[model samples]
Target: MSPRVLIVGLNYSPEHTGIAPYTAGMAQALRESGWDVEVITGLPHYPQWRIHDGYPRTGDPHEVIDGVPVLRVPHPVPHDAGQLRRLGMEIVFGLRAATAPWGRPDAVVVVTPALFASAIVRVRAALTRTPVIAWVHDIYTAGLSETGAAGGPVTHMMRAVEGTFLRSCSGAVVIHDRFADYLRGHMGVAAERITTVRNWTHISEAPTVDTDALRRRFGWGPEDVVVLHTGNMGAKQDLTNVAAAAQVAERTGAPLRFVLVGGGHQRPQLEQLATTTPRFEVLPSVDNDTYAGLLRAADVLLVNERPGLTEMCVPSKLTSYFTADRPVLAAVEAAGPSAAELAAADAGIRVRPGDPEALVEGAMQLHDEWITTGGATHRGGRRYVREVLSRGAAVRSFVSAVAKLLPVTTEHRAPATVNS
Candidate 1:
């Protein structure tokens, strides 16, 4: 009989943006791989902090989606939540999840960003005699401190809590080398216990479409340079820099049109900012397939991070940008993981996070390169992603990491090929 694996995470699909889709995909992949995979996640409330339509705050704790069993727990939903509110929600969810009627599993995989919940899962795994893997998306304490939310006296406490939880886990997986180093150096985790499993492009493939017609549908013309920033328009994304860059470009008679596509607590602010600039536009989030189409249609793909987010995150947007086969203009820390990854992949251009002038300059340069090279420079992004961050490679690595936690029979070693 195959071993049963329980995945504990705050976000999972039906929620399109952030880490939700990735978690869902990972779960599905594991199921296809012959593991009896089960998930425990909260009601889907993410970039737009309200719970998704049809999923009530109070309802059945169990549901089946795409053939996998999901155990949903009710947690507080915070619309436009701040650090304290977010923290409270996490705690509530953790408390509920700890008491969930999860049957025995061979092992557990806890996804962080629900840092408190990971601790609960660790305790549960200890009691059940099950090995646990802390699959870390972002280094919570360091990231929260950098964001100024859990700074000052609480920062040390946060780190201590995170350290204790991670140490308690049988093994861990980090998305970046920097994160692994932080875990080892700051949290005192042994080097051998941590595995670096980078994220892949969540969107399956860039659908072939008529670029000109799609641009026209969005009111973009041949002369207009479409620069797009897709995904959650949340506080962590310093999207105001896109508006500022568009302002700077207009002053220089550049034909740049900045498009912010997605919704979040910051949506209204972004809309107000867009109102001041004719060249700036804001649109609601589209389905993943439509988003992939937009990526293929846009002239330039943009990524902006709030300043001081150096080690906080490795913006999942870059993986999609690389897969989009479009030129990228990133406004992020020069030494940050996103910057280094883009540079190493030879994916696209980068500038300091907060500088509007530099952003505009990078935009213009990429636009010029697009016109001159006919987007050959941008097309390199697709090849880079395929070679380095292929979805198959990521799934293989993930399964390998999980298998090491417990012995798997040779018959169960091979994972099904995931086309999505």
Candidate 2:
């Protein structure tokens, strides 16, 4: 009999971006490391807020993905949900998950984004005497304040709630050291209870594509220097700044063409903005292979964020950008996790956030540098990926961290049965 672990979160496999890949990767890695792993997650609805094609809107809730048993809880798939509406969806999912028939497991790992849902899962874990590990993807309270989503009394209340949920966990895993510090210093979680595991590129292979043909497919010309930004186009992403930079570039007659590839709540507004901005283009999300190819084909990769969004989340796209082996440019706070990560990797250049003129300058600088150096300047990014962000190392670290949280003794028993 093997130790069993259950992972509860709002996102999982088939949603290729954001937290889904990491959660899916962790589940698969745990199974390979000899743990019997199962996941309780919502249906695939991410970057694109609607459910993915081929999945029933309402039907059977159980499926096996990549050999791991998953219970998919149906939840609201809002097209452009406001904060309150989103919270309502989280509550509904949490209630459903808490009442679901998951067999008793030795331990549980809850991913926080669906923070309220995680708290509900924690309460259930308490009843079963199962230790819980919190996988912190973002600090919800900080996000509310940082992104200007909410503040004052609302943020204060959320801080109290988030702190309570994290402190109650047996241990917590954070993706960045900054997050660990935030947990210990602000949230009052003990330092010893937190582990830092950086995210790794989930794309297993470097994309192999004909650069010319790929550019041609997108209608990009030889003279055009495409600066691509992929992933969510949300308030935090502040892609409006990217659009502004494109307008600036067009005015200055720069060869740069800014392309945003992803869907989110802000996509419609960005599309409307794009109609009048010749140098800026918005494309729908692409499959993993196409995404990887786009990363490789572009002259530069971008990470853009709203100004003052310093402490809420680390841009997950940075891992993929490094793997893409292209010159990178970030429009983010100088002190934020994304800037720190890029500087540490020696991967890219960063400009002040919300400054369209500075962004255009940075893009042109990177383009010239890439042309002059023949793309040698950005090799450090690929080297960094191999040396520091290898998937095997990341998965092993997560497995080891999780092992410490499990009970030392267990009865030899058959697999636990699911409740009917």
Candidate 3:
């Protein structure tokens, strides 16, 4: 029989943005790899932080997607999440999901951001003699600290618990080189135990859409230099800098308009800011195809990070942005992973965070450069992503890492049902 694999995370698909798509893609790929894979996750309430309309707020049960069994657990959805409220919700979900009847498995992969629940998974794996892999998407404590959500007795306690969980897991996986270093240096996880499997874009390659038509539809004219930032608008993004830069561009009479295209907890504040800022526009999330088209259509794609976000995690959107073959302008820490990736790929320009002047200057410079060179400088990014960060490459690395931990068997038979 094939090895039965169970995945635990706080997010999963039908939710197109954030960590959900990656988790869904990983699960689907594992199923195709001949593993009997299943997931134990919360009802989708990411980015917006409110449960979707049709799904029950509580007692959400098991459902199957593309042949993978998903066991949904109940958890509170925080409308306006602060540190304490977010921690509380994650704890609730972790407890409920830990006790969920997910059945026996040869191995389990617990996804982080669900770090509040890592302890339960550790203990359960220990008792059941099942190996567990911590598939880390972010360095949780570092992320919390960088996002201004850490530094308290609660944070101290949680950090200790998280470290313990990391050490206890059979192995861990991180998405960036910086993440691997953070795990080793900050969390004190042994260097040999962590594997860096870079994230792949969940958005597939689709035929290009009518760029001219969409530009006109969104009120962009030939003279308007559109700078688009697409994806989750969360605290980590520091989008206030974008608004400030828009103001700067306006005051200087630069032919620039900044559009933030996505939704999240921070969207309402950005929306309020847009009401008074003429050069700033906020649009809701689009379907995957439209998202791809918008990426292709924009004159410049922006990746703006909060000031202190050095290396907590790599923004998953960068993969898609690179794949779109657009010039990226990242306002992030100079030595950070995002900037480093841009430097390595020669994909885009980077400036320090919180400098609206720098942002305006960078945008104007990139715009001029694009026109002069006809985007020759930005062509290498897509080739880099296709060669290094493709979907098949990532999943194969993930499978190889976990395969070492689980029992090796040759029989490839049907997956056993949970109740069996």
Instruction: Report how far off residue 304 is in candidate 3 (Å).
Output: 0.6
Q: Candidates' TM-scores?
A: 0.94, 0.97, 0.95
- List model 3 lDDT by residue over 260-326, tens digit each: 9987889999999999997999998787888888888888999999997887878888888888888
Write candidate 1's Cα lDDT for 1-420 as tens digits: 677788889999898877887788888888877788888889987777888889887756777777678888898888876777888888888888778876667788999978987887778778878899999998888777876776578999889988988988889988889999889999999998888888888885747566667788888888888889988887678888889888988888888899988878888999999889878999887777778888888888999988878787787888888888788888888878888888877778988888988988888898898779866675666777788777788789888888888865533432222110
Better of 1 and 3 by lDDT: 3
Model 2: lDDT of residue 139? 91
State the number of backbone clashes in model 3: 0
Please rank every candidate by TM-score, starting with the best. 2, 3, 1
| Best model per TM-score | 2
Instruction: Give the winner by lDDT.
Output: 2
Looking at model 2, report the run of 10 residues with the lowest lDDT sum.
411-420
lDDT, each prediction: 0.82, 0.88, 0.84
lDDT of 1: 0.82
What lDDT score is found at residue 297 in candidate 3?
80
Model 2 RMSD in Å is 1.4
Candidate 1 vs candidate 2: which has greater lDDT?
Answer: 2
Q: Which regions of candidate 2 are displaced past 4 Å? A: 415-420
Deviation in angstroms for 51 in model 1? 1.4
Cand. 3 TM to true fold? 0.95
